[model samples]
Target: MALSKVFVSLMLLISLISTVSSTGVIGGKALPPKKPPVAVAPAYAPIYSPAPSPIAVPPTPAASPPVYAPVRRLIAVQGVVYGKPCSDWGHDTLMHASPLPGAEVRLVCHGKPKENPLKIMATTDKNGYFFILATKKVSEYGAQKRCRVFLQSAPTNSKFIHSTHMNGGLSGAYLRYTKPAKPLLFALYTVGPFAYEPLPSVCHQKV
Candidate 1:
């Protein structure tokens, strides 16, 4: 009797297990088989187009600086030359000294009553005027100022440095004087002892 009971119990347990599985009780439903994961294609990097280079804007040019010229000292001289009347000088009575074309003239400054005066020379215009005539023509000069001057005719070799015992009736000083030579010289000279040395010295050098 016990052997039969044991067999019967075994069969009953097997039947219960099968029924539980098929009925889906206690989470016994058959599970779908898991497929292997699909192979993933590697994502390609986006094609590299070099990033557009930024357009460079050029900077504006700097403004140019202003330029200036040096100031020139301007002097004015006016006078009559005696025989220096140019070819155009019409009459003997016309302001004969107005201007003499082609006459070369000079002006001078003396370091003192003794030393040779500093000389500045110029040729006359058609009007017989010299801008560089003499420094005393400037408003800022005086009589008894130690100076001597002479004029030379170019292309003619005619020089007319003048000789004077009394100029402008002043006693000691020599002044701007005129000698009447168209191509001849208009110059200044002294009767004093100092005159000889410089006259010949200058005459030899330039005249």
Candidate 2:
């Protein structure tokens, strides 16, 4: 009839807008609101690269303490430390041999370090000749009217007489025993010798 009612009213308005655009109500397009599901931020559980810190311990070095030395004896007195034109006591030389043959000769036994302490007994061999034998505490070594002996050319092989004297002699050694003491024959100390003038006098009488 009128073009079949304008083609059946545009075919019922395009079949009610394609049946409300597939049920999304109205002329479709509200489907865009579903974009809320695009929040895909839940897959970050694989970043396990963290674990390194522990190593530091090194410091240790401390332990040392102990040393006390002093014990020497063997006394036999009958000496000689000549130099300075020395000869006579059996008359043997015009200074025979020792201008300084590794010097050092001391027999300090008269109230040593303190009361009675000087017993380096003996030392001097290598053409210098020294024979010590004084260490028995000499009856506890306590009766010093005198027993002073010294020839400290610093013995112990005085480096070939300090390489050739300069002040080597330093001279000294003396004795004056008198308490039933008499076995000291020819005590000759040239470089140096003393008793009241050498050095000795502390004090002792114990037993």
Candidate 3:
């Protein structure tokens, strides 16, 4: 009986060892092999973002006015007058002529046909010079082309007589040497040194 009891104890101990080695359990709980520490991923920063842009616009233009200039006007006419001797006729008589102080001269401008011509008159001063301020009529004539200076009359009491020598006593003298006159608002046109002649009888007497 002692031998049988010992044999039963030995059998139970061997059975326990076989169960522990096959299942790897100590107290009925499983001990699985420790899986390599689960490889963990690292943390990272968030991606960057930018804001939006604005739209563009165009500009407007300005308006302006036109400008004009003023026109030049005609103002005055001037000249000198002289008296020639009978012998000085039909010859260059400038040096032989003398100033006719109180002589009368006329400005004649022929306008459109059938219309009365524009006429202006002036007298010689002490130095035989004459300056005629333009009238509204003369300015309207626009230019000096159609105009002329003629000897109208000489001092009646003087020995000088109206003669058609050198276009001074009868014919017309043209305008020349344009210049500026006083008051800065007008133009001055110069004419010739018109002349008159002494009587033929007077010339013979002097001879």
Candidate 4:
């Protein structure tokens, strides 16, 4: 009617530019442009701290005191030898005590007087006894602080005479300290009845 109302307003402006170039959200349902709110950096949920438990120390008790070892001692000695027939046959300490069989005892000491004395021989058994095991390396029983018992020999058909006062004479017969000696010896001595005295029949001056 005026060219059909200007051709119906130019065909309604080309149908609204072909619905905004074929649906890039011109009319309603295409909602994708509010990008500025994306700064939501607060949701960082990584807080996990739970791992630490182990502390136990208790054990110390042995307070010092228990160490022992020391007990070693040794020594041994023994004796017997007697005879008495002539102080007139009776100085009677039991009427002339016999038993001097095969006698030959010696164990004298007093060392270093030029080193040749400390005898140590033994012989008198048949009832006369006489044992000797004393030793601290060659026995004078402890090698010399004291030692004696010397009747060196007596039995040439019995004429005997070593009664240096018969043992109570006391200048000897010492060294007597027994008990304790077994693979362990330092000193141990035992002396005797040790006596001898028969000699009063000498009549021969024939020239």
Candidate 5:
């Protein structure tokens, strides 16, 4: 009986030693449990923004037609020339005066400042009538105040010389009236009846 009890105690001691070795325990302390492998998080895909839309533009407008101004008409200046054959011819009335045929008249006009004056010339017919067409438009020279008419020359063979009558032979004559000429395209401006007179010796010879 004593030998069997000793054999049983020895077997129990061997089993306890095997259990401690398998559990990884030593010096009467228990070992910690084994940790599981850590799981890795998946990487996120890169986010991309969409491209912007293009801007819209308006269409251009159509071109317009050109405009033009009306054209101006020409103007005609008309007048008559007279003569005093003798010095005894009175200055009061034009009855003793005769038509100075083949006489020349000049028209002078001052327009804008610093610009050259406008000059025109005309000759008298057998009736001593004269007319000059303005080279430029009437609007260019302005009103009649800007223009004057003067006697330029007379027949050299005639006994009469230039005389200051009706402000035409010596000084300048202003426009007197305006009328419409024939053909309806011309504007007639009447000026004066300029005159010429003989020298004192011619009248003395008759005396």
Candidate 6:
């Protein structure tokens, strides 16, 4: 009608500019070609290890304990008992070394026998000489103090006599001491001239 109403208002202004350039709006504010900003990763943040080598490690010395040797402890003893003539076997003669008064001596303390009660006998003084002084504390110094020197009984019962610890008077004679480089309150033992013989098989049993 006017040119077909001006060509129908120029096709409704080109269909509203093609519906706002296919909806990427424009003045309503959406242009659409930006997308590049999504990085976000820090919930603890702390990982960097490499620095330790100045060089130094020396610590090891612990082992030294054992040096034992100082135990010499025996206290006293001294002796002599005589009377010879069984053909003077242990010859300590001065005309058969006499001195054997009354006899009977016994200081047998082998391992503390009953706490040292060997009845403590010690006779022989007319110069037969005998001494024993130790009421407690003996044995120590290579320790094996079977302390003996027995010649118990026999100044003379004369059945042809016998005593060098007479196997019959019960074997004895082991008390020896001498250690003095410095240490003494006792310990000077000199046992024996312990003798007695006369039994040539009792003169062959009165042949």
TM-scores for the candidates = 0.28, 0.29, 0.60, 0.26, 0.59, 0.29
Give lDDT per model, in order: 0.42, 0.42, 0.75, 0.61, 0.76, 0.63
lDDT of 5 by residue, 1-207 (tens): 999999999999998899887987866788777688888898899888887787777777788877777555566778888887664454644678888888889888887789888888888999999988887535423447888888888777887774656655568887654755445565567887777777777787887
Q: Judge candidate 4 at residue 116 and give its lDDT.
A: 71
Steric clash pairs (candidate 5): none
Best by TM-score: 3
lDDT accuracy of residue 142 in candidate 5: 49
Over the stretch 95-158, how does candidate 4's per-residue lDDT look in tens digits? Answer: 5577877777776666566877656677878787777664444543344354577767775576
Sort by TM-score, best first: what order? 3, 5, 6, 2, 1, 4
Q: State candidate 6's TM-score.
A: 0.29
Q: What tens digits encode model 6's per-residue C-alpha lDDT throughout 28-71?
A: 87678768999998689787787887688777777778879866
How many residue pairs clash (N, CA or C atoms closer than 3 angstroms) in each of the candidate models, in the order given? 15, 17, 0, 2, 0, 0
* Backbone-clash count (model 1): 15
Model 2 residue-pair collision total: 17
Give the lDDT of residue 9 in candidate 3.
96
lDDT of 3 at 129: 94
Alpha-carbon deviation at 79 in model 5, angstroms: 0.9
- Native-to-model Cα distance after best TM-score fit, residue 30 in candidate 4, in Å: 2.3
| Tens-digit per-residue lDDT, 63-169, candidate 1 | 98888864322233333233322321222233323333555444555565576655665565554444543443332234225444344443133332322222221
lDDT (Cα, 0-100) at 141 in candidate 6: 51
Candidate 4 backbone collisions, by pair: 1-4, 75-180
Which portions of model 5 miss their true places by more than 4 Å? 1-72, 87-90, 181-183
| Candidate 3 Cα outliers beyond 4 Å, as residue runs | 1-72, 167-169, 181-183
Score candidate 4 by lDDT: 0.61
User: lDDT value for candidate 5?
Assistant: 0.76
**Lowest-sum lDDT 10-residue window in model 5:** 135-144
